[model samples]
Target: MIGQTFNQNRPLSQSLDTQGLKTKTRSFWVPLSIFFVITALSITVLGPQTQSIFDTREHIVQLQQDNRVLVDKKNKLTSIDKSLLTRQARIAVSAIPVESSGLAALATVRNKAFSSNITINQLRVSEGESSEKDAAKEVRLQFEISGSLSDLLKFIDSLSKAAPLLRIASVKMVGDGVTISTDLEMKTFWAELPVSLPPLNTPLNQVNKKDQDLLGQMNNLKAESLGFVAPASASARENPFAPY
Candidate 1:
């Protein structure tokens, strides 16, 4: 009886020990395995994506900076364009006019000669050959005048300062001690009306130093007015039946 009891107790104790060992394994190894699985998922799934997100943010910042720079450049270009247009308008006003004709130019020369006390013997005016590509038309004038040397010099100087901007092409002079006979060939310009303007995107050309100097010279020149016509009051018929 004593031996059987001891055998039975021994079997029961072994079974209890085996159950405790199983409980310890469930508590330790199961949690450890789960932790390892979660760590592997993080490394495999989220690690590469973290760097990609940061790179995308940096790229977006760079694009924003480039956009700001382009906007600033656009504003500056707009300001420059406005300034150029204003200057161009002023230059057009001071430039040789398009409305002038050979008759008008001849009249101007006659007026200048009369004012200078020079006698004009012969006056000829003609239009020069012009092409479609030219911006201005050329007008030629040949004239003969007689005056003392001092008076001739003064007349020539006045011509240089005259408006409708004459260019002296040639001068032939024959003197007979008492009076000098001068033949002059002069050229002047008249602008053609613009048919169309160039495209807006065309690049603006900067004025050169020489052209700027010429503009300054023109600005300093005195303005010349076309001779005034008498008002209607002066020409009105004092008698209603004068002429039609």
Candidate 2:
């Protein structure tokens, strides 16, 4: 029975083989069509949009450059702040004496001026004579400094940035180089000044100064801020006695 079945299917196989070639078709057309469609959509939609962005290439480059410059400036400013904070930490800020006026900050300035290879021959200072009764009062001062040109410029620049607000009103330069002389009149400010102490009926310093409250406060301020350590909180450190 198996031999007869094999013999019968032989002709059928031969016939199918001859007809199969006629029905055979390639399968690449569907994928090829999809590829064309995708390419067309990208060129018509996404391609033009991307090309527009390229048109602004010059502007984008300039903006990037500007941003980099600004970042550099920011870094420089940050470095300056850190340097100032470090210096302030090393040297405590003392309250200037209210009476002598400009004695504290001015001394610091004058010392710096002298050390900066500058010779200061003449120095003058005048504390303001405003009444302690005045609400808006400042302990004004006048200074005339003679020094080398470079050293004087550096001194002026430092004082401007330093705390307590040292200001220069006038500067006169006489010569150049090693023989240079710069005369500067400078001023520092104090918001309130203490009143001049008067003759007391009782022993001195016993009675409270009711009238010259600002003056007394100014004296205390000078004492406290004159190279005194800031409180722990101001120092950005934890106070040991602070409540837990």
User: Best candidate per lDDT, number?
Assistant: 1
How much is the lDDT of residue 115 in candidate 1? 80
RMSD, every candidate, angstroms = 13.6, 25.4
Candidate 1, 64-119: lDDT as tens digits: 77667666656656667677656754654445666655655665687778888899
TM-score of each: 0.56, 0.35
Model 1 scores worst on lDDT over the 10 consecutive residues at 198-207
Writing each residue's lDDT as its tens digit, candidate 2 over 1-244 gives 9999999999999999878755553365678789899899899988997888887797788777777766666665556657654443323222332234466655556556665766666666676554665433344444556665676778777666554445677777777566666767766654434456543222223223562463333333312134454566554447857766
TM-score of 1: 0.56
Q: Rate the local accuracy (lDDT) of all candidates.
A: 0.75, 0.58
What is the number of backbone collisions in each predicted candidate, taken in the order shown? 0, 8
Best by TM-score: 1
Task: Report clash pairs, candidate 2.
Answer: 93-227, 94-225, 94-226, 94-227, 95-222, 95-225, 95-226, 194-215
Clash pairs for candidate 1:
none
